[model samples]
Each structure stands twice: as C-alpha cells, then as structure tokens.
Target chain A: MQDIKEILWEICKAPGSPGQEGAARQAVKAVLEKVCPQAVLNDDPMGNLTAFLGDKHSQNQLLFDAHLDQIGMVVTGITEEGFLHLAPCGGVDRRVLPGSPVDVYGKERLTGIVCCQPPHLSDGKAEKVEPVEEMYVDLGLSRAQAEEMVRPGDAVLLHVEPRQMLGARVTAAGLDNRAGVAVLLRCAQLLGGKPLSCGVTFLFSSREEIGCEGARVAAYQVQPSQAVVVDVSFARQPGVPPQKSGSMGAGMMIGTAPSLDACVTSRLIALCKEHGWDYQMEVMGGRTGTNADVIGITRAGVPTGLISVPLRYMHTTAETIDCKDAEYTAQLLAAYVQEKGGALDG
Target chain B: MADLKLLEELCSLYGVSGNEGPVRQKLCDLLTPFADRIETDALGNLLVYKQGKQRPKTRLMISAHMDEVGLIVTHITDDGLLKFATVGGIDNRILCGKQVMVNGHYGVIGGKPVHLMKGEEREKAVAVDDLSIDIGAMNRAQAEQAVSLGDTVGFVSGFDRFGNKVRARALDDRAGCAIVAGLVQSELAYDMTFVFCVQEEIGLRGARVAAYQVQPQAAIVVECTTAADLSGVGAGKQVCRLGEGPVVPFMDRSTIYDREYYELAFRLARENGLLCQTKQRIAGGNDAGAIHVSRGGVRTVSVSVPCRYLHSPMGMIAQEDFDAAQTLTALLAEHIAGHPAV
Candidate 1:
C-alpha cells in the first residue's frame, strides 16, 4: 500500500474557491505531473483539466470527474468601516457563517472573522438562524488600506486545516472533492506504465459544486462513449437517516440510479466482488445529484456510471472522510480499468 | 418618450420562458433592419452583435429576458379544469380569479368566490395548488384537443394606456425588450451584443449559457424591477417607486454588482441629465446574477424601469421610466465607447 497522506494534505490545504481555482488546480497539476509524467495533459477554456493514459481511442472508460473549486465566499462589497460583505460562490452553510474565521484572497491574503450578533444584545428571542445578508467579515483594516489592497470579486475561504480523526479519518473544508481528486492521482500512480486495452482519462474538472457546469462542458468536448463519475456522498452521521447515509470506512458507493447506465454500473459491482474489494450501493430515485446527471445527456448522450466516497458533514468546514475509503476507492478504479471495463465492450 | 405603438406590440406578446420560439421570430423580424449580425443558440438566446463604427476596446453585452413568469400544466380533472404549476417565483395571492392564456385557449384561474368560502378558508390566503384554470371546456376530451398536457400558460392581459401610464402582463421584461429594439436602430460608437435571453425567470439559465458563448468583458442588463412605494409603506421598506426614473440596484438576492459598474451606471445617468434612482431595499434578481460569473467573471450591473405590482396580470409602468431606461442604457454604452475600461 502506498502512503498518500502527504498528497491529500496538499490538495485539501490549497484554497480553490469557485472562480479562483488556480491555486488548487496548480497543486493537483503538480501531483499529476509527478505521478504520470508520460500521460498527455490538457485543459479547456473553462480551466477543466484532464490526464489521458493509453491512446486516445473509442469504446473506452472516461472519468466523469470531480472539481477542484471549493465552497467559499467572494468579496462582493467593502463597507466604509473596512468590513467586507460577500456572496457565496457555491454553497456554504448559513449556520456556520457567523463568527467563523476566513482567509480573504485579495492582492494579499487577509485573515478575518465573520462578524456575528452577540447574544447579550438580543431582545428576548430564541437564537434564530440569520440569513447570509446579515453577515460581514471584519478585516481590522482602515477603509483606505482595504481599498488599496482588496477589490470586489476576490474569494474568501474558511480557515480550517485538515485534521486527523479517530480511526484514521480526516476532516477539512473541501474533502467533498479534494478526496476524489486524491483518489484519481493515486489511481494514476498505480496505473503508471501499465499495458492495458482500456483508454482511461482522468478529468479533474472545475466548478462542480456551483453547478455541474464544469463537467457539462468537458463531457461535451470529450464526448466519451462511456464514463464513470467520482464524487462525495452522505455518510452515516448524527441527524442523518440510515437509508440516506452510507457507512464510513466500508468502501466507495456504486451509484444505482435509473438514469445511470445499468450495464456499466453492474460491471463495477462485479469487479468489486471478484477482487474482494469493499463497496456499497447508493440508490437514487431520480438523478444521482452528481456530474453524471449532466454528462449522461451531453450532446446525443453518454452512458455514464458514478462512484462516490462516503463523507459526513457535506459543504461544511468540518467534512470528514475516512482515508482508508479513499485508498480503497483508488484501488477499485485502477483494478476496474485493468479488468478491461468489466465486459461492457464485450 | 416610448413609442406607444411599439410598446403595444411588445407588451401583448406570448413569450413565456423555455418556449420563446414565436416571440423570437417576431423579434428577429423587428431587429433585422438594425442588426449587423444576428444568430440564435441551441438554448434560444438570440445574440444580435452590432459592431462599432470605430475600433472597439471592450465587448459589451446588454440583455433582457424574453421570458415571463407563467404557468405549466400539471394535471387534468374530469371536469376539464386543469391543475397547473408556476414556472417561476409568483405569489399565489395575485393568481386567483385572474385571466390566463393556456396554449392559445383563453381561461380564467378559478378561486373560490369569497362568498362561497367556508369558515377559515375565507380568512386564509389562497394557495396555488388549490387553483385550477377553467377554459370553458366541457370535458377532458375537448381540453386535451385544444391544450395538451405540458403546454405553457401565460397571463392574459391586454396593453392599455392611461395618461402616460401603461398596464399589461409580461411588462416586467417586454418593456425591456422594446427599449433594446430601439437601441438597435441608433448608430453605435462601441461594439455591443444585445441578447434576448430565455428562462431568466426560472433562474438565469439563458444568460448563463449566452454569456459563456459570448465571453463579454462587461454587460448591462436592462430590466423592470418592483416598486413598493404604496401609501403607508415605511421608508426603509419600499424597494423603489414608479415614475422615479430608472432604478439601478447595488445588490439583490442572487447577485452583488461590481461596485465600479454600478457606480459607472450612476455616473452615466448624471452626465446624461437623466433621473436615476437607487433601490431602497435589496430584493429581486435578474440576468446579472449569471452574467457576472460567466467565463472568469464579468463586470455587470442592471438599469431597471420601476414597476408597480410586478409579475402580475396588471403590472404598471410609467412611460417616463421607459424613456429613462433607454437613456441610461445608451449613455452607458456611449461612456464605455470613450473610456472603454476592462
């Protein structure tokens, strides 16, 4: 087994808030270069990155993918008091916005905390959730100083570093996607210089959380015949229903949605069983709520399958994912590719 | 002043979102005389790219939604009354007892006459689910023949003029459409693209795709915004007032405008000697929500005509507000033509 703790740490630590994804994209690109130096790499006008192993041939398995853009705020306005008001790039839990520490990326990185109403000044009402409108960040700079350095449209990220949890789990702000990115890199590392019939393309797409826009354009550009999307799913946690959540540390979940390509998905399940790998089933009544939804119907259509890592507290700063599950996912993707796409082409 | 004849044509159209084909054809014919380059995309956004007489510095996109908030057919009862759903955000209180156009068949949305209401139902606000459209059909068979399931339904209101005031349905944006149509005829100093976008009321879908396709450096969305300047309304609560020129919003629910762009709009208004009002309260959104974030972000702001009782069958706007919207859009384009900042 390879130790990828360092790689995952570097990916989760970089701030790639929505439109400002250069930092995270750069970090992921560096790792891809180191792991698969021979693989052909390319990026689209929208900044969607892809790494291709094997020849660019038809009837192959293409990765539907995950994005590097994380949920954070963009500086929308600066108040005369030197405080900044923000617009959320993707999704940020409104309950977590008040009083949270943030790093605003402007001309220079500015450390600040979201200002909140103190309870002592309240007038006898129970603590109620306030909308994002009432929230602002205090940078402790004068108006002139802030104007000299920062401008509107800058990004602000939650200041939470990845931490080790009990039982080999990890928690951070962007584990919803950075973990998926880590799995793809590890898969490439495992598949380095291997002889294979399957043409595997890893799409480290951008702007997934805001919408499936990044992959929508990528799928349209690539137009791959077959695809497998990697994303994050809800894990068993407090206040979560058992039917909706998967067990952490079990394995990655193979999505079972009516919209998903049944043959390709069943093929994945068959490989997991044959290899004695840990796996689970995630059933959706409609869409799987991933990039596969958009990728499935791009152009005429692309038959797509989905695989998701189980994580708790999605979209929160403290998103938790078991590192073992990520390693297991990487092994499964690499083995599934080596198995000649599990009889779908046959 | 707005040409009442042109305003009449715009306000009386049936251009609901996601189904703008008929409206697009008519609009194309009207713009063909002025448009240097006109093309429609897969998602129904009509891009009318007009080049400048001089060298262009920045690409400008000025847009207005061709779609209006309307109804979608959901179910049909045996009595031929259709159970319907709203296509965009619409208050249920304004829906009851209003006339509607469902796929060419005129009908009336049925609400329990207050005299027929029983007990608490009289005291409660009417919900949309409780309403049905009566198209004078005797049975499900006749209703199906004229209007099939999944057909779009829009409010049925005709344009009327009363002392420089106009009231009509879809004026929320058809008013914006007329303003751009006039701008297309005038000579331009800077190259600009005028987009008639779709599905904006459904959440800026057309603008999102169109902005990506064009990748403009800056954009201005001409729209009609709500005016809550009714009698007894508090100062901090009124969003804007009708007849107060054009309302330039600083921020709204879906977007926060670039400070420089909003200020630029105000500056153009000041230089042109046109009346421009700032929104008193932050509320509704427009295509700026999606346009500003498309393709590495764009500088976008909105110049809206103040509308009273917006998104309804009887929305009202002043002719002078329409004139102000036209002036603000022209001056902004003219100013950018000279300054031309990225």
Candidate 2:
C-alpha cells in the first residue's frame, strides 16, 4: 500500500499537459518497468504506450488501460508585472483557479499564485466571477526575472500534494486518472504468481485529459479481444444528484452504456459477485466519455468494460478519492482476468 | 491523355443529390475491371472489393462521395423559368446569373437585372426564391420538354487546368470520387472496400448506411475541403491552401481522429516524402461523422484536397493537391494491407 501511495504521489506530481505529455509518459514508464519487467514498452506516434505481460502465444488477450496525462496550464503570454497569462490544457474551472498556487515548469521551476483584481480596485459592483482569459498568475518576481524563468508554451501544474483525509479517504491533484494507473500497477504486482489463463496488456496512456488520444492509438496497436478502461467517475458531491453519483467508499462502479457490450458488463458483474466484492452500477445514457468509447470502436470492434473509482471534484486542483475504492477496483480487475474462461453471455 | 482522362469521364457523369443512377453505373463499369466483387448498398453506395492472398488481417474501407451539389425543381413559373431549391449547402449569393444543367439539360439562371433593383436590395445577395432557371422555354408546356418539376440541376461545366490548378463545378466531392478511382487502379495487399457513396452533399446519408453494412475495421475518407487561403482571410483562419498537398485533420468539428491512426498517417507521409498538413482548426464535418460512430466504432482518418469556393458553381482546386491525396491514400492502403493491424 505504501509503494502504491508513493507511485501515486510521483505520478500526480509530474507535469504533463495535452499534446505535451512527455513528462507524465516518462514517469509512468519508469513505474511500469519496475512492476512488469518483461513487458514490452512501445509508444505509438500518438505517444500511447502499450506494456505487454505474459506470453504472446496465449489464446486470448485482455487489455487494461489508464490515461497518464493530467490537466495543467500552458503559458500563452506574460504581463509586464511578472504575471502570466495561461490557457487551460484541458477543461478547468475558472472560478476555483483564483488564489490557487501553481508550479510553472518552463526553462526552470517557479512557484506562482493565481490572482484577480481585489474588490477594492473594482467598481463598487462587478461580475462576481471573471472569465479565464482575464485571469493571470503572479510569480512574485520582477518582469525581467519572471520572463527569464518562464516563457510562452511552458507547462504548469497545481502545487498540491497527496494527503490522507479520513482514514480511508485521500485528497490529491490528478487522482482523476493517476489513481487508476496506480490500480493497474498494483494489479500487475498482485497477479505475478497466479497463472493467468489469457495474455494481458497494460497501457498507461497519454493525452487523455485533452481527449482520448492515447487510448485511440493503444487500442489500435493492441487490437485486444477484450478491453477494460479504468478511469475515475464523479462521486457524491455537494449539489450533485444522489442517483447519478457513485458512493465514495461503496466500492468500484461498472459502467453501462449502449456502446458498452452487454456481455462484457455482465461478465464483470458476475466476476464481482463471484469474488464477493462490493460493486455498483453507473448508467451512461449516450457516450461513456472514457477510453471505453475509443476502445469499443477499434478495428473489427472490441468488447469493452469500464471500472471506475469514485472521485469528487473531478478536473480540479483538489480532487478527492478513497484509497480503499481504488484497491477494490484492482481486486475486481484481477478476479475478472483470472476467472474469464467461460463463454460470455449477455 | 493521362489517367485524368478517366477522372474527367467520371466528373462528366450526372449524379445529382437524390438520383445517382447514372454516376453509380459509370463507377460500376470502371471498378469491375479492377475489383474481385462489386456491389451496391440499399442507399446506392458503390462498394468494390479486391481480395488479398492472406485471410484479411484487416478490413480497410476507403470512401469518397459520388453525389454533387444541385437543385431540385420545386415549382415552374408562369413565365417559363424554373423555381428551384438547393439540395445541399448552396451559396445563395452564387445562384444568380450562373449557368446550370437541369438533369443534364443546359439552362441559364434568370433573375431581376441589376438596374431594376431598389435601394438596399442591390446590396443584398439574391435569395433562392428570386432566382429561376431559364431553358429558352416560352411557357410551362415548352419548359416541360427540356426539364420537369423535381428534376435535379447542377453546374454544367467541365474541368479546366490553369497552371497547376484545376477549376470545375462540383469538385466538392467529384474530386474525392476521382481519388478513390485512382486507388482502385493500383495493386492492394489487404482486402479493400472502395465506396463511392451517395447523398454526401446533403448530410452524409450514404456514408451512414455504408459504414453500418461494411462494418470495416478502419476507414479513410477522401474528400475535398474548403480552402480559405485567399487574400482577405487572415493567417489563423486560412483553413488550407491550394497545392499544399493533402490535408489530414487532427480534430474536426464532427470527429476527433484516432491518435494512433493520425500518427500512422503522419509517419507514412514523412517516410514517403509526401507533403501533408494537419487541419489546425476544428471546423466542418464529413463522412467521418458517421464512420466514427458506426457499430462499436472504427479507427478513422480523413485526407482532403483543398478547394476554393466550395458549394458554389465554380469551385477551384489544385491538381497537384488532388494527385498528392491520391498518392498518399494509395500508399497507406498498401502499407496497411501488408502490415498487421497496428
């Protein structure tokens, strides 16, 4: 568990923005090599990495995927007062950005604070919130010094660290996906001696925060018969519909979509029941908005299933998740892979 | 004549939006010689197949729409001019004074002369209702002889080369049809399905049905896109330039391309020394709108020829760009056919 926590810590701290996911790629690659030493690590032109486990001659192939990239910042311009104008690499809530601390990674590292006009400087009453365009980051440096440390196109990440909340709950930045990646790593480590009936491939994908770009390439290259995309789903948060949100410590959530093959979902459900694991159902009306949407359409079409870890405040600097839920997800995946022999019936 | 002679023959065939029998028959004739099996779907999409020696490791579907922008005659005026509505996204501004062929019959558009217009009316572009087709008919009886109500009409023009560029009507997709035709003439290693789809000008109706039926592992759409590289347009909004080779879209409004497929295309373009540009802006939809969502889903990519004044009677495109698109598509087909699913 401590090793898994360290892996998560390292991954969340890495800076990888959309279209510029090399840093996260290197971090994920280092961890993947440590767990699956014999696994082949190859990156497609899209920067998607596929790590293969077990023998190639295995009759069936199962692929598990988790996107490596996280939401961050790209410096679009710099103001004269050492403030930085930034564009979101992925979707970011502009309202929460003000007063948040960020680490700008350009030619060198620099810490900055997101600032807006103080109420005293504004007209007696203005719009309560400003658009992201009007916002800027103050690095507490002179214009010349800030310009020397950071330039346009440099990446920046939230200056937040992982902290254990209420015993089982953990709060961190980028738990939206790095937690899923940690689950895959832990699953790989747990299933070492247990003989697998089929070949398994683990993919720590890149560029998913922007779009499912990495999953698109990994699925095409692997062309697996069966695919499982592990990502984070929104949990029960304040003002969120109770029915729609998955419970935080209630266990793993299985996605149900018209695009998701019924047989795959049922098989996963049956596996969870067989293993006596706590599980819940999530209904996806149209698109799953995960890698499952991409993997389901690859080539002749692959039957895909999704296992989600419940997280609150997704796509934010202070995203929160329960560590037990992540472990349960890993356990569910390991059980499904080990007991996936019978003909899949919807 | 070069292979373009075949292309010209294809372009000359009349296949307006709803009625595409003439174009379908012509494509069938041209594809029969090169295909192992040729068939048509319920929506009139032409599917031509060439089997490979190996049990097809991958099923590749290459598509180009056969339908061109035209007008469907809705009413005939008492003065013998034909009142029509456009079947696709037609620039109403270009409708006046343009010559159109009604279902292969020659005609000229008749509308109010510029001198007869009132204040502010002259500044505004002509609407569809104000324009009508004149086929030298004195009455409705005489107008029925040359064309009829509900008859489809399109620009009656031929391709002409000026320097390295080619100007023509309906190049919005006839150029795409020609590229697919060129690929069919080449040797392919993987089992290939060439679809000359119909009704693409309207809403990609034919592509939707074709993708549902073929259920291909991967698809590549050959298309002609709007080239806004004119003098007035700014650099950021200049969608494409003529003779800049084929343009591959990274993200279009309709679909975001599969990253692996997009990377594979870029790598292939680099290795072959072919000139290709990525669509920087996400605008316009194509057959990919249907191809990306068909069945479970397909890894899809689009290669387009940059054309000026798309959806107008006189669209212009560079022949070199068309040729470049054809060469790259053929090369990709060969590479995928020989290699594994990756």
lDDT winner: 1
- Best-performing candidate as measured by TM-score: 1
Q: Least accurate stretch of 10 residues (summed lDDT) in model 2 chain B?
A: B108-117
Clashing pairs in 1: none
What ranges in model 2 sit over 4 Å off? A1-3, A124-127, A341-346, B1-342
Candidate 2 structure, TM-score to reference: 0.49
Q: Write the per-residue lDDT of candidate 1 for residues A204-287, one digit (tens) a residue.
A: 888877787889998888877778888888876434567887887788898999999998788889888988888999999999
Docking class of 1: incorrect
lDDT of 1 by residue, B223-342 (tens): 998876543245566688767789899998778987987898888788878888988776888999999999899888888998765666556678888998998888887666556566
- The 10-residue segment of model 2 chain A with minimum total lDDT is A118-127
- Candidate 1 vs. true structure, TM-score: 0.50
Candidate 1 positional error at B143, Å: 66
TM-score of chain A of each: 0.96, 0.93
**Which DockQ values do the candidates obtain, in the order shown?**
0.01, 0.01
**Candidate 2, residues A90-145: lDDT per residue as tens digits?**
76555345445567887767765555332222243323444556667766455687
**Per-candidate TM vs. native?**
0.50, 0.49
